[model samples]
Target: MPAVQEVEVVVAHRERATLRVGDMFLKIDADPERADVEVQAMAIAPVPTPEVIWRKPHVLALAALPGRALGRLGEPSAASSTAWAAAGAAVRTLHDAPLPPWPGRSLEELAARLDGECEWLVTNGVLPVDLVTRNRHVAEAALRPWKPVFTHGDLQITHVFVDGDEVTGVLDWSEACRGDGLFDLATLTLGHEEHLGDVVAGYGADVDLDVIRAWWSLRSLLAIRWLVQHGFDPSSPGCEVDVLRARM
Candidate 1:
């Protein structure tokens, strides 16, 4: 008799779903284009990524990464500083690679989206007006023009995996595009501010700390609504709400 593989739903929402069955992941996206982007981005990214086993119209299968995730949003990372630094170095390599063919959200697009999301947040009473206003002001600092690079647009900590001091793999490439490098930096350190130095040390570049901070606020503010609709809790300790509160 063969051992039964347990099916685990890694994430699920209206748009997409990821399932883990033993050592393989099955990604089901509403849009096949997103899966196409994921495949292409993984192929071109300099960093390690999950191996693509196969793909259908809306479903893609991939081999699971070997190591645990870097960390979760609402939890402290037990991963070593060396592991964090290794993730940063791998990110730097990805950023230095040739720009992907697709473009990321432009400054105007992001600013407009920020405005709309903020309005919705206030009108729906999802967050305090004062809190929304304060973070909106901070978010302005991240709206400035910048040279584009190959960026993993959603570089969440959970998406990066590490084994000891080495970054074993990075996941989720549908959002990859040419965008600000610091946005990736900010996203990686979003809920885990204490490890910023370790990441910067490995990035080995002079970055504007203020800009990264601005991005932290901006990304959090922009994410809250989507997170809520997607059944995620942003107000948990060490999560998005805390990241915004830390700025205040």
Candidate 2:
């Protein structure tokens, strides 16, 4: 026990905590033994390509930055143009970074799991396969010729930070993977069109927009399957249906 300190939890599904070391800052995650020491080692490793920057579990000694996330950056008006640009470029930088081998099951494996969920639900007559099949196909195809690269598995407005067209840092890498840059781009652009516009303009990167859209469409359907399986208020309407329907 290296003198236990205060544990501050962050928003998101996984358990993450920030510890106070007398006058120092240390981040800790749940581990059975020598967690602090291990995190310290990870922190010293070259920050895993920018995309996984958010996903790694490490204790860094860097100052936090200013500005809010893209979602909270306030509606896309005059005031947010710079923030918008920065968010997009930051994500681009992340996707451009070379990646190390990711440690989870491949995207295809995950998508197959989603299909299993869909099959189980439809078999039980919970939801129509027609409701999810179109999107599921999109998801499968996106993973089919997967080109592994640094990717922010979850690229949402809320996960990005900004400071006048410059990303001081990107947060939340727990879902990071070495996957298609197009996949990451599609994930961010799917729901938030405004953000997508800004990102395209800011990054000025060549991405197969169609491929991104396909994956985006598929992810939505997968989400619906998860919601239904987890008992998350079935009556609750979600954008998955709209995205899936439009594609079909």
Candidate 3:
């Protein structure tokens, strides 16, 4: 066997750290319960996901997927429209799978959280009050009830990997639970709106574009505070702040 390689930090913060070693990724999470949920979610997801290598008290190791990420948060995607469509199909498969035993955030919980985040944004003057108020109204549409589906609660573009026009794998299942299907779609295309048509077409279902747009505002508004506190620049082009600005 080859000698174990040196590990490189992929991402790190107080909450969690991910390290890459040769063909494997070791995720050291602050919350072991989240790690357990990630492991179980990966086991039951219908779409292709990283192969689990092993698990310990606070660490979970997985084999790297075959392809590169579909896109980064603040960068243009080089992936073709077909690859975006393939990601949509993969999400459809995940949603069609039996609901996970765990529950996701309720509409009330999401609203309460969004309210608090909005208040924080105003209090800190992170963004103009008018912009926050406008987007808050837009976000209200997404608060309505819907039939629950198995959702990859955090389907950020970078988590979906693709090779050519095929979706090779998806990553990060800690937030996986029964939730609104549109939330997954919206999260996947958050800042990458140009690809929405392709993703919707591949989903093979008619979706409410209004609700999707609402989620864009809702997600962006809720994320800015966390992104800022975590040392991420939400004002970068194609990032959460930019997404909010586009709505104005």
Candidate 4:
């Protein structure tokens, strides 16, 4: 008889839940379209991604990748500089690939979202008014026009896996779409500012440092409310709140 595997709840909130049983991860999203995007994105992405085992309605099953996550948002990554570079190279490949059919958020839409989020942050007293104002000003730099590229829109550190300085797989493709390449770069190096140079080296391209800093503030501001509602702590050390605080 085979041994029964334990089911670990990887993540859960109102809209989605992920369960891990043995080597299989089952992601259940309330929106089936998100799962659809994930499967299709993995199929078309140039970089390595998790294997799709099966799908049913809003639930998607994936086979485990071979390595540990590059790092967590609030923690220092133990991955070597080479590994971080490899992740960067992989991102560059993804950005250079054919654009996804879907269009990403427009500048107007992003600006509106930023404005709304900033209001919420201050009105609710979630953050100091000065901090919110400073980041809002900084976020303005990233609202300019940008050419679209295939982007892993939510390239959080936990999504990239590494083994022995090699990128084994990238995960969480539900947010993939045609968007700004620099946005992806900024997202990868968000909390880990020290690794930006290494990532750019692997990316093998010169990019605007100011724009990346703008994105750091922008993304952090846009994320705090959602994180709090979702039972996450954006204020934790080295996380989104700290990212905004640094901008102050």
lDDT of 4: 0.93
lDDT of 2 by residue, 23-69 (tens): 33344455423343333323432332122123244443323435545
Tell me each candidate's TM-score.
0.98, 0.66, 0.97, 0.98
Worst window of 10 by summed lDDT in candidate 4: 100-109
- Clash pairs, model 3 backbone: none
**Per-residue lDDT for 214 in model 2?**
77
Q: List the candidate numbers ranked by TM-score, top first.
A: 1, 4, 3, 2
Model 1 stretches astray by more than 4 angstroms: none
Candidate 2, residue 104: the lDDT equals: 36
Q: For model 4, how does the per-residue alpha-carbon lDDT over 1-248 read when each residue is reduced to its tens digit?
A: 98889999988999999999989999999999999899999999999999899999989999999989988888999999999999899999998899988888899999999999999999999999999999999989999888899999999888999998999999999999999899999999989998999899999888898999999999999999999999999999999999988888
Deviation from native of the Cα of residue 56 in model 1, angstroms: 0.5
lDDT of 3 by residue, 215-242 (tens): 9999999999988888778899888888
What TM-score does prediction 4 earn? 0.98
Global lDDT of model 3: 0.93
Question: What lDDT tens digits, residue by residue, belong to model 1 across residues 105-151?
Answer: 89989999999999999999998898899999998999999999999
Candidate 3 Cα deviation (angstroms), residue 15: 0.6
* C-alpha lDDT values of all predictions: 0.93, 0.56, 0.93, 0.93
